[model samples]
Target: MKGLTIQQMAIGDSATFTKTVSESDVYQFAGITGDFNPAHINEEYAKDTVFKTRIAHGMLSAGFISTVLGTRLPGPGTIYLRQELKFLAPVRIGDTITAKAEITGLVLEKNRVTLRTTCTNQEGVLVVDGEALMSPPKA
Candidate 1:
C-alpha cells in the first residue's frame, strides 16, 4: 500500500477504477452526503427535470476519480489537494463507469502531481472530465 512519491512517479503514470452505478449506491451516497437533491433521490421529481430521470450525483462519479489517486496511481498515503471537474453527461443507474487518472505534470520541489482525470461509462461515453493537483506521499 505504499504510494508513489513525487520522485517515484513519472509523467505517464496512470491508473483506473471501475464501478456500476446502482440505485442503492445512489441512495447510500445521498444519505452519506446529505445532498438529498430530488434529481438524485426522487424519481417523480427527477421526471420533471431536464434529465427526465433520476441521475447519480456528479460528485459520486468524481469520488471514483479519488479512488484512482488514493489507491492506484499514487497508491496509499496520497494527499489530495485540489480538483477541477466537468460533468459532461448524465450517469444513470446501472451504468458502469471507469475512472481514470494519468500523470500529466510533476513538481519536484512541491512534491505535487498534476493528473488528467476522466470517467467513461460502459457505452464509452465520457461522463466526467477533470484535472487534479495532489501531493504525493513523502519518501
Candidate 2:
C-alpha cells in the first residue's frame, strides 16, 4: 500500500492485523523491558495466579496496534502523538491476537488522527481497548 499522509485519511477508516503469542516472545519482551514478573515468565508461578499460566504483557498487545499504524496502514514516517489504553484480559502463550484500529476523528489542520483501537484473542475476547492519536506524513 502507498504511504498515507495526514490529508489522505478520514474518520472511519480502519485496519486489522494478527499475531500469535509465543513463549519466546514473552521472554524477549521481558528482557527488553526489564519486566521479568514471574507471572509473565514462570509457568509454575503463573499457575498460582488467577490466569494459571504465563501471560503476555499488556504493552506487548498494545504494541501490535502501534505496529499496524506505523508499518502497514499509515505506514513509515507516521508519528504517534498520544495513546490511551485499557487492559481487559490476559493474553496467554499460543493465543492468536488480532489488533484492529478504526479512525474516529481527524484534524487535518493539525495533522492529527484519532483511532479506536482493540486487540482480541482467537476466542473473540477483548484483551486490550484503547485510542491512539497519530500524525502521518504530509509529504
Model 1, which residues run further than 4 Å from truth? none
- The 0-to-1 C-alpha lDDT of every candidate, in the order given, reads 0.95, 0.90
Q: How well is each residue in 12-89 modelled by candidate 2, as lDDT tens digits?
A: 888998999998999999999999999999989999999988899999999999988888667788888888999999
Question: Each prediction's TM-score against the native?
Answer: 0.96, 0.95
What are the per-residue Cα lDDT tens digits for candidate 1 across 1-139? 6888888888988999999999999999999999999999899999999989999999999999999999998879998999999999999999999999999999999888999999999999999999999998899
Lowest lDDT 10-mer window, candidate 1? Answer: 1-10
- Top-TM-score structure, candidate number: 1
In candidate 2, stretches whose alpha carbon ends up further than 4 angstroms from where it belongs are none
What is the C-alpha RMSD, rounded to one decimal, of candidate 1? 0.9
lDDT of 2: 0.90
